[model samples]
Target: MAAFTAADVKALREKTGAGMMDAKKALDEANGDMEAAIDALRAKGLATAQKKSSRTAAEGLIGLAVEGTRGVAVEVNSETDFVAKNDKFQDFVRKTTQVALGLGNDDVEALKGSAYPDGGTVTDKLTENVATIGENQQVRRMKTVSVGQGAVVAYMHNAVSPEAQDLGKIGVLVALEGDANADVLAALGRDIAQHAAAMFPLALNADGLDADVIERERKIAAEKAAESGKPENVQEKMVEGAVKKYAKENALLSQIFVKDGKATVEEYVARIAKEAGASIKLVDYVRFQLGEGIEKEESDFAAEVAAAVAG
Candidate 1:
């Protein structure tokens, strides 16, 4: 019989985006336990997503570097965005991305263990940088894509630094594999990269999407179909049809072309191939939106000010 306070209900409402009364009821159902309340909401299908904590709070730069047929994008996060604008910090991100490109390694620990120009390991240099810059920083993640004969074009959205070097807050890498002119392929790749940044497609193809994600969508669609009071056999067919539609909508190749909106992405690529006089295959793509999946710590600025004054 734990009593849930108004503040507790408000906090739960903010976190789960449920109404205040719903939040209070949820808290009461969980006996005033926040984590349990989150789980309870999930059990009742009230939450659109599961809460994930323990992600990095650090924020800095997402670097994109393309050389020859390969490109790499790495995220180096600091404690503040101000440090992301620092010249030294930008240089670190640029150089680290270059290092990542050559290493052909995706493991953060392995990249850190690799050599750096200034003597010690990459991790060691990063540590030295933290002390020198007076801000805590780390290489959060890296991804690489390459094509043997095609082009890997890159684009930086909202670039705030040098053109030839650092891109911006959002970085995209698109690899086009084909026999077309490298220049033409590069242009097409850039267009696709920009599309990726805007579209956020789930996968390159139907098979690439996570099984769990597909099943989750399947369950939801099946439940909706069942509500029609249709026969179970007919409902199964409806669910299957709905799943196919979901796959096409979420898959990159089946998605409508963002450039024209009249054709699918596959059709757009086919048009590009016809125009370029060669068959173009989108081998892979990487899109990093500054903090798409990361949750930031929400603080009460007014309360902090009052506490400082009291101190």
Candidate 2:
């Protein structure tokens, strides 16, 4: 009997981009171990690296606020896109974000407990919204970035709609520190923010990348290297090279700027700094793509169709 269920096969297929049969076969080989099956698919070059932000199932909006050198990003989640487009829901996110910005903190629980603009705590307002909108809502997370000497620029990619200004699917904040003019810093910061939205870098630099992520890449690279039929030393070099390449690509500063393609993001920033006659540093950034890291529920299309036909 097959050890994995049909749903397991479906999930494996979604995660690895493998065909249904391939996912099922891989899962069977691994005795229903999802991670092991994923590795098997990648070892055979049938699957790509795991996208950390794989599922976009959580419907929500990202609220952004920038006050001079300080900026904040707040993610408020709802159950459906219908609720996301609702005016009341968007207003809750916008007001919550402003409250967070005023708090100048990164604590979601604190922001939830803080007073809302409409004479209630943020959490009170959220509960009210959920009841009034007839959908579950949550203040998932928030982050703030600031630079004393420079600028904290903001960018929203694919705003929920034209009406949802300062709220979007992807919100980015970039903090640059330097003595450059405000206009120069704002321009450069916004360009970097836009790049961040497109690139979706995992960390500010290669060294800041998560150790678990690096180790997983190493394991996958080693498995692929073993297939080369090369000497042990060559295999070691290949594995290290692959790991380094993965880190370089995932790290924000080491990535090639999406704008020019030729220049690395670090080099691009440096070039701008030189032009502005200041030593600008990319201090920090936040790239909040809606529904990141959320495991969304899935349905069986076959079952649903069968049920509808029977009905």
Candidate 3:
């Protein structure tokens, strides 16, 4: 028989947040050795992360951070919204965004492989978090934006706290290029970032818009034109006009400014530049709305209760 007692199992469960059966099994496997049991539980936790990976993680927070002229936005997803409110989860999101800012690249896989502040690799820490938090968590996506001579500003929508403004439901980073004064650049960049968070533009400009998206728009426009029974030449003109309008509406620079609605984003930047007496260029931007494209699994609480009773 294993040498460990009931108290050991309880302690192991408290330490690792493993199920009672899992804790007892690990303790038995370790032959009452506490450290060995911990190692076993950690290994099991890694396995648990793998098992939970297939579960949809469509709720959580978008974390944003800026350092000097560089900024990063990250989307960390949890299985439920409740997990997003967890202090530990918020801390992890904040720290992960900070780590991402240092990386200087927007690669999520590389960020996961990077060292975490507390101890292990970021991926390892995430696995441990899943074990402790009792839910699947994912570092879904990350984006970094930087300007060589200007500023990268970050903005968070639905901020949880004024102090920790980086944790929120939506995050935006705008990179402005030019030799403007630091204060002026930061102010302009913040405004642009805020606009980005609200507008959710598909690209910085029409030229930067996705080719497939343009093609899809073109196809839809052609179909619409066909329904009008227009001449072939007129239909061609109509399709081209429709595609251009779609691009203008979806691209950041061409989109109407959300603030005053009197000017396009490009015009707004030009106006800001003239006022600041500097040539400011809207170089790039990134916006992340938490779980924007993820489809969450729908649960039927009544059915679940019925099944439990039947079982």
How should the candidates be ordered by lDDT, best one leading? 3, 2, 1
lDDT for each residue of candidate 1 in 207-259, tens digit (9 for 90 to 100): 99899999998999999998999999999999999999999988888888889
Every candidate's lDDT? 0.79, 0.85, 0.89
* Model 2 agreement with the true structure over 249-294: per-residue lDDT tens digits: 9888999998888999899999998987898999999999999998
Q: Which stretches of candidate 3 lie over 4 Å from their true place?
A: 1-11, 20-37, 302-311
* Range of the 10 consecutive residues with the lowest summed lDDT in candidate 2: 46-55
Superposed model 2: Cα runs more than 4 Å off: 1-57, 299-311
Which candidate leads in TM-score?
Answer: 3
Per-candidate TM equals: 0.76, 0.77, 0.90
TM-score of 2: 0.77
Cα RMSD of all models vs. native, in order, equals 15.6, 16.7, 2.6
Candidates 1 and 3 compared by TM-score, better number: 3
Comparing candidate 1 with candidate 2, which one achieves the higher TM-score? 2
Residue clash pairs of candidate 3: none
